[model samples]
Target chain A: MAVLERSYKRYAGALSPEWSRFLIIPRHAFRDVFRSKLFTGLYALSFMAPLVFAILIYLRHNTEALAIMKLSVVNVLPIDATFFLTFVEIQGWVGFFLALLVGPQQVARDLTNNGLPLYLCRPFSRSEYVVGKMSIVILLLSSITWVPGLILFGLQSYLEGWSWFSQNIPIASAIFLGSLVWILLLALLTQTISAWVKWRLAASAGLIGLFFIPSVFAAILNQMLATRWGNLLSLGSLIRSVWAGLFGTFVQQAGQVQRMRGGVIVETAMVEPPLWASWLILFLICALCLWLLSRKVKAYEVVK
Target chain B: MTLDAPATSSHLNDSPGVITLDNLSVTFGGRPILKSLNGDLRGRAIGLLGPNGAGKTTLIHTLLGFHQPSAGTARILGSDIRGEANQIKSLIGYMPERDSFISKMSCIHFVRFMAELSGLPPGAALERAHEALFFVGLGEARYRNVDTFSLGMKQLAKLAQAIVHGPRLIFLDEPTNGLDPPARSRMIKMIREIRDSGQANIVLSSHLLRDVEECCEEIVILKDGRLVVYCNLEEERKANKKFLMLETRGDLKSFVEGIGSLGCECAMTSDHRLKIILQDGTEIRDLYKLAAASQVQIRRLTYKRDSLEDIFLKAMENGSN
Candidate 1:
């Protein structure tokens, strides 16, 4: 229709399926997200770690490069569980920073601007709206985390042959599963804060405080009470414990601590919280975030 | 541009009533907001009117499925709001009263986003978004961010998004709120045009009785959470046709006697002014003929039909009783 005619016309076109309608949120959200130069820069920078990991995997297989560097294949960082574990840890932190940059404004913008009714008044539900906003962080973090982590694993599997791939399948599982857990946690936590805080800067600070402040309190508690149970209060410690377990390094990392007492060296095994406790704490935190999210994300507020 | 034939959705039932409230009630924290509102609103443009705190907005919210009805249910386009809210929502468009827009989105993009959420395919949504913007007279500023638009522009943008997807029913909550006179007239004109187009049913909730009186064929007036009045505006106006006011010269006694002989009730408010309540089967022509025959010149004549304000005020009085 020409702009001059200025007549309202009926749209008789076909509609998208109900199930896939939620994808529209992320589709539009991605456009707004990439419009930010800072976010775009950070998102582009996120791939550097994956690119560097791929180079490390390539160098481990290139005997010419290893010899030129005066290093043997054995002396180079082995493409093993620890190697992938370190890769996941670095990518996980990168994903956190990426989410921190983007996630705080996802739900907060809608609530602050009175946009929820526009969404809810459509065929969309509250859960779909939440999932749609959550998908922004989920998709972005997945690309930087497990998606590339698995690609790196596939590269090693292709280069090192079937025997190496068959023997070290757990490392691949750990990279995928561990990154998934962290991504879900970050997505839910950041959205929860966004919904509650409703201010972008304050929400960013809340996300940082949610993770770091608890760890500080946990450290103080552990020192004062002499208990490993304080790890339950620290989300970072709980997630680290879970990641360590997933990578098969929990036992090794918790094996021994050597300290000097009375001018003598005494080696003692450090006590650690049960891996199940960490898993339980993370699950409870995620559940709490979801409950809090459900409470705040509404189209109308009821006043009495 | 040529207009397509009005599209009808397969999901919509061919019911006469656009919205049917079946004893619907809503309470917020034990305080009733809507108390058993029951009516079948079937007009092309239904006006919802009430004083402040009379539950006008709450009724719209309940029908939109924003607030679940505490007692009974309402049907929008033949779908039950309780069981088929999603289906009802798919067939309806809503223009909220408050300022609602994505903070940084352009007018076209915001309307397109709303269209997509309403179930239009992405390409169709973008196309219709442009058409809707143009229709609302925002074509020149479609590229501007909605937040940067003036209040009038924002109201038009909200309207553009509401009608973009060709919904079967639309809920317009205070659509003319905060608009200046020209903008308000433009909004009212567009609303009447939409009503005349026969493409969608409108539920216009507003505090301004003039806005409602101008655009609506049927009205539902609420008072203190109760359905005080529900009637067709044309029928209400027609019912008040018996009352008339007249200014006259010459022999008024003969004219009064002639009016009384026609079974009309006439009261002499002053020497030259008369208030006549015409009886059934009496027409204004009969009075004019009687005045001519009685040698009384009918100087001025006015039919005193009840305005919407009168109807609203009367309803409020009766609701209080």
Candidate 2:
């Protein structure tokens, strides 16, 4: 019917495919997410790390610029596994902050304003709803995390030649797969917190507390119990272990000297937790978050 | 605009009813909210009526696939709610009793989002969203955030979203709740127009008997999770006809006897008032002729029937039995 008629009319038009309907959630959610100037600024700021990394990679290959500065190749930071690992770590934190800002409000607003019935009453399932909300964080995080990291990897591969690229193929995989693990973990955790805590500020705080509070407790447990097993409580430590394992630098990073005493270097030789254990812990944490999300994301509560 | 188009699909099977409950039951924590509700509701506009705590909303929720049926299942538009819930959801729209809307979203945008979720393409969803907002008399305010709307406007926005996708069936729970008279009338008028448009079937659940009486062709009343009564209002109204109340000036006793002799049941409520149930083929002119013969001045004569309130009360009493 014409808009001027101002009456109910049957829409006999073609419908979108059923599988693509869930995309509508993220489409609208992205509109709301980008509306925040603070978030937009932070998101734009997230690309600075990759841009700096890209320039550094370019400088490594640019001998003329280096000669003009009268600096040798060894004087600058080496673009090794450590370099890419540090880049992944920095982007991971950026992803975390963005998730904290965007993820908490994804499901909380719907729950707080009684909007789930409007969604769940349509041709949308709870699983689809969760996936849609999770995609908001996933897409935003992916753009900053793996997407730019891969572009940087490709740039280095093109500049450094096939010999270095062939020798360090795992770094490329580590950049993509490691970033994915972190992004998925952050997305799931924030969404689970959003589903449980209907208040946005509380959900954001809950996400921060989930990461920081446990690390503090883990530190205390490690000091008192003298066991590295306590590190399992710390998500940050687990993720670092997993990332180090992914980059094949676990041995080098884990055996660093702790201190120097009495004019002599004191090497602690601290053995890191097994890589499998860290993977298991992260998987279990993600699983628990999924369970909590499934339990809380519903159209109505049954009060008995 | 005049609505003359036939419904695009006749997929709603009449024999199975628009909504068919097959021993449907729902329980929360061990207590049953809907206890084996079994019936087929087939009407252009079906009214679900009950007092508070009567499982009206629970039944709707069950049919919408929000609550799992503890015993049996229901079907909407020939699809099993359990097996084809998403398909059924695509065909149906729900306006919940309580306030439900996305905050900080414009009215048109909210409706458009809902339509998109129902599988409408973006452009069509937006177009329909605007038409729906305008149809609900929120055309001027479509761009305003939903959180800023008054209760009445919010109700209209809820309706706009519910109908934006051109659903085959619509479930409206408390559609006129907490509205002033004019807004309530407007809402009722919209409901009637939608029902008459024949583009969608309507299932209206409300406690107000007048609202149901005004809009519903058939009613299903529940009490204490039990089916209290299911009757066609049109048939009930027809059957309740030929009943009248009268006030007369003289010879009430003879007038009563004369009314009985003419095959009408008459009762004297007071010295000057009478309640008469006219038999079939009985005419009011016959009563007037009898009243003149009896020298009784028929001062005030009024037609009376069992109203929806009376029907509801009788159902309540019978349901208690």
Query: Which candidate has the highest TM-score of all?
Result: 1
Off by over 4 Å in 1: A2-4, A252-268, B1-16, B251-290
Q: Residue by residue across A27-80, what tens digits does model 2's lDDT show? A: 898888899999999999999999999988988999998998898888878898
- Model 2, docking class: medium
TM-score of 2: 0.90
Q: What's the lDDT of the predicted structure labeled candidate 2?
A: 0.88
Q: Considering just chain B, what TM-score does every model have?
A: 0.89, 0.85
Candidate 2 iRMS, in Å? 1.3
How displaced is residue B128 in candidate 1, in Å? Answer: 0.9
Q: Compare the candidates by DockQ and give the number of the best one.
A: 1
Worst 10 residues of 2 chain B by lDDT: B1-10
Cα-based lDDT for every prediction? 0.88, 0.88
Total clashes for model 2: 0
Report lDDT (Cα) of residue A81, candidate 2. Answer: 88
B24-124 in candidate 1: lDDT tens per residue?
Answer: 88988998888887777778999999999899989999998999899978777778889999998888889999999888898999999999999999888
